[model samples]
Target chain A: MTALPDTTGKKLGLVIDLDTCVGCQACATSCKEWNTQGYSAPMTDRDPRGSDPDGPWLNRIHGYEIEPESGHDSRVVHFPRSCLHCETPACVTVCPTGASYKRAEDGIVLINPDTCIGCKLCSWACPYGAREYDVDHGVMKKCTLCVDRIYNENLEPEDRQPACVKACPTGARHFGDLGDPGSAVSQLVLERGGFDLLPEMGYKPTNKYLPPRTKRNTPQAGIEALPKGDGSAMDRLFKLADRLLSGAGN
Target chain B: MNPAYSVIFFTTASGAGYGLLALLGLTGARMGHAPSLLFAILTLIIALGLITAGLLSSTLHLGRPERAWRALSQWRTSWLSREGVAAIVTYPFALAFGLVWSGLVAIPDAVAPLGILTAILALTTVFTTGKIYATLTTIRAWNQPLTVPIYLFFALASGGALHWAISTILGMEPGTVPPVAGFALLMLAMLKLRYWGLIDNAPRDRTMANATGLGEHVRQWEVPHTSTNFVQREMGFVVARRHAQRLRKIFFLLLLLAGGLEGAATSVPAFAVPAALILLIAAWLERWLFFAEGEHVVTLFYGNPNA
Candidate 1:
């Protein structure tokens, strides 16, 4: 069962826009809130009230300072990392108990807590560090892409997205069938030249990231240019100040 | 990458156990006179005990120790499962070989076949253990061609040292075992040194830019969390250069002294136990370094992208 399926009929995945992400952490927090109570409940904190607090979280946001290079300006990029639901997920195949598996229907990688021995090899196999070991329950927990919400009939069609996508204040996260070339997300990827993270590792990640857009030349705000003077403004001002001081002394 | 002691012990102990089992299987049936029943029984007990202890210790780190049995069911795709299966399968053959060697069983002809079977299974188990780490592309340090040979050679050397110790204790002619063990030790030392060199000089292919799909000049200004997370704890192990160098020197010295002592056992006959003990310690240190120095690609996200 650990052998990956030949193909998933639909590659459901996310497309994130770095240019739009505000790094507010709403997506990460909402993801934690939802998943903590959802499929992988009680993502327990080992020392919630102590000096060194740690816990399982499905999503994490990292901020990077991209230095100016060539013609591009410097910018801070907020990167939200989660499981990419790779077409060839090493995490899934490395599971010794068949506890970790990818859904053949949608390519969403998930861990079956009932079968998991919590050996943690799956976490080591992941290049993105997507899986979190839940110490309290002794199971591996990860982003299920809100499988409970996404497929629930109780939710409205528009509200059926993953919690991270729904909670993104900047509309930075998009979820759809990435396998379909004509999907809106796919089109956005095409237009923005979205790229896969760590493509050289060759997991063939389903998710994509839209790179930050290049900065454009613009005038500074709230500042006015000084009037031109032939005498040179700084020199004239110094001379005027000197004359005033001399007159006062006389 | 955190070099959990439980796993380190598991690998080293099991590696030595399997190596001893393999060597016994290869040589047991061919001896001119059957080894003393006590020697045979004691050898089997030590080898099997180490393997069992190692396996039990490995379960200590698991989140659910009771569910460890399920790990053997996924041999179709998982190297861990394969390792478990190989180990389990080797047990019956190894037990049979022990019985036959001790003359507890009536069939003398069964020794050769059982020994060969046990040897093959032991080698398979070790190979699967090596593959468990080597197949993980996420860890550049472990996912290499050198990993398998290193595992095999270390097992051989440590196991050889144990075998030599037993032979010397039983008052067997020292000429028979020490030479082979000395040779294995030399090979293990060379391979280990080469592996270290390879990892030290290897170019890191995973970078921050590629990891985030950002540009080449990207540098982490802030990590995802203010405190350490699971990923950081599991895969973000860092070793200071000075400490690592010191450990390496110790490891090398211990291994070399073990080899020298084992070789000297042929003349002095008193150095065998010390050699075995030193070899075990050396193997432990080597295994520790294997895990401590390994850099997982996932650590790139935590401002150590270059590591």
Candidate 2:
């Protein structure tokens, strides 16, 4: 089972937009809030109210300042990091137990806690740090792409999506079958020139990231004086009436 | 990257045990010529004891040690699984080699073939263990051509030193043991130096720009969490350049002293124990450096611009 399947039915993944992300951490917070009680439950925190509070989290937001080549000033870009669910993930093949596996139906990589030995080798094999060891449970925890929520029939049709995607206030995070060329997410990727993180590593990740767009180039707006009215008694009377109605007298 | 003590001890202890086991199996034909029956038994006991203790220590690091048996199921893909299988397969051959050499079993004619088979299996187990680290592409320091060779030679040198010490103590003639072990120690020291050089000069190609798909000059404004997470605590372990250089110097001094003492043990038997002891310390230091200095690619997301 550690050996990956040659082909998958669909490559369901996310496309994150750096330009629109505000680093508000809504996605990360919502991920923790939902997942703590969802599929990988009891996501224990060592010291929640103490100074060194730490726990396992699937989504994390990073902030970086970028200096452009020319014309644009330096700006802060917020980046969200998570598992890409790669086509050839070393993390899957390196698992000694069949606990770590990639779903052939949806191309979603996941860990089976009941069978996991928690040797932590899968964590080392992952370049993106997607796997986190659950110290209390003695098992490995990961994103899972909100498998419990995405396919649940109990919720409303619109509510059936990854927690992070549904929680993104700016609509920076998108989820769909990226393997389909005609899908809306695929079209968005084509329009924005989406790229993969650490493409040189050759994991062939499914998820893509759209780079921050260039700063807009437009002049600042300013107020201008009104042209003199045509020399006419009626025009002058109209101008005086407009000034009185503009709250100038108050 | 955290340099866990359990792993360092496991590799050093088990590697030396396999090395010594292989040597014993090769010399099985001449076991009757040993000083006494007790010598052969003691040597086998030492080898097996080290192996058992090391195997047990390795499981201590696992979060679910009770489920460790599951590790042996994936030899087709995982090197760690392959290592487990190899280690188990070598044990029966090793025990048989012991019985034949101890003059207790009546397989006198099978000595040569059994010796060769046990030796092969022992070396194979060591090779699989080395591949576990060498195959991980996430750590550039461990993912190199020299990683496996260094591990192989260190096992030979450390085990050879122990063999020389034990033979000299038992009043057996130290014919080729001292010289061969000394030479192996020399080769190990040279290989370690080259490995350090290669890792130090490894190119920093995976940078912040490639990580975030941002512009070239990217700097971390702030990390996601204010407190340290599991990734930072485990993979973000960093050793300062000054401290690493100092450790390297200490390792070199220990290795040179151990090598010299191993060579001198041929003339004076008193030098044998000290030489093996020093070599053991040097191997521990080298193993510690191996983990402490390794930088994982995951660190790039935790404010490291390059891996």
Candidate 3:
């Protein structure tokens, strides 16, 4: 263990602006471009030109559509996921080889690839599944939050930010030293009501997400006061089948 | 969750090895094969080789390899640690048994007869490995009591098929293994049927809200980011129900035919060996699907939870 002081008092994290996020995959693409060339086996892809092609990428966006069964516009939300660099990383604790560890200074979860045996037990123990198996190195991989870029003294001080933060065309991501409460990222979180993803998992993810904006037209009386819609063909079919199954067929 | 092939191979290959070791125990091969001691030693070597390779493969997935020993410290609480310990303990006994089989050492001719005891000990290793997965309470799919027995049976069937195939290729003397392979395959079929039944009767109740804990009836309205993260890459995979159903059918037929071939191979060695090889491949796929299809309860939070 490097035994970096409990920078817990000063080690900062990210706060994602979900409301402003446009579901664009710029961050993912930039992350892949940076990490692949900069670290490990490029999170290698097999048969990139072939039909069964897949590659290891540290970031991805998921699209979700939430619509009322009654009448409402679907709320589409896009979530980008990475390692979170949690304050309490389960992945680090469960790692047998000390290959996985948390930097006490910044609370960044890192895997020392040299000792990684690739047992993948850490993956199972993780609810977030933050670790990816790097086939080329025969070791596990994860997002380092552009560790190479963030702290590189060779780079211009202005360039000392994560690749995803730099590439984000939308101002949805903030990178900063979370240790400073007055930092723009921290203030944004406090003002925006940012919440942790899956707080119940107890990993204490360093990244936070601004909650979805509540719609104004939604009624309060459960299903009764909600606007109605004509049943879709499948919905109509299911309703009839449900009636029959409930023994009210006649 | 990234389905590291190495770990998969380790668990699966070792499972078959342990299963074969178990079969060697159960069939009354309790004593030395004397003249065939070389064959026994070769077989044990192959078995141990596969097991060690598997262990090696699992470590390859770790971000830090040097800290692998820390896993052993958790045997009291972790099934993974127990697996490590169980695997190590079986070796000394196995080496001694090998010596007894080769007539290099005398068994005092009294204590639990080396043959049966060796067989039982080998099977114990397999049982322990299977239990490693079955004992995890956090992953509902793996936590089932049935998982241990199923893994044991499948391991035997898989190893038996592989053993028969290899033997024929090498043109070894036709030992009384085909029938045993057949028996193992039959048991595997029954085990698979039971496993499918168990899952059906208790399909997971994972919900978006329950998983994410954002609300009582949570649904994925949006993902907050645009990049693939740990959760999605590992737990996000899904096999179409229709495709899974088809695979299950194919799996059943493959095992059934392989069993039949093993039984008939006693009279027709040619057919049995090829069928056994095919059976081995099918079992590997079965094992792969078993892990792939299993849903982690944590998926409820990220959405696209398991069935």
In terms of TM-score, which candidate is strongest? 1
Per-residue lDDT tens digits of candidate 3, residues B34-149? 43556666767876787777777766555545667756654544456667767777677666666765556655352235556655665666676676667444366666877877
**lDDT: worst 10-residue window of model 1 chain A:** A214-223
Candidate 2 residue lDDT tens string, B1-307: 8888989899999888887887777777545333457877987888888888889999878989999999999889999989889988999988887787776786777776777788788888888888989999999999988888888888878888888788877877755566667777888889889998999999978887887888688988888786988887778886787999999999999999998887677678879889888988888998889888889998878778888
Q: Give lDDT: candidate 1, residue B160.
A: 82
Predictions in order: lDDT: 0.88, 0.86, 0.67
Poorly placed runs, candidate 2 (over 4 Å): A68-71, A217-250, B29-35
Task: Evaluate chain B of model 2: give its TM-score.
Answer: 0.96
| TM-score to native of every candidate shown | 0.93, 0.92, 0.65
Residues B1-307 of candidate 1: C-alpha lDDT, one tens digit per residue: 9999999999999999998888888777665224778778877888898899999999888999999999999999999999989989999999988888678885788888888888889988999999999999988889889899888887878888898888788987533455667777888888778888888898986798788877788889888876888898999996776888899999999988987887687778779989999999988998888888889998888887675
Residue pairs clashing, model 2: none
Error of 1 at A200 (Å): 0.3
Q: After superposition, how far is residue A50 of candidate 1 from its true place, in Å?
A: 3.2
* Candidates by lDDT, descending order: 1, 2, 3
Task: Output DockQ, candidate 2.
Answer: 0.68
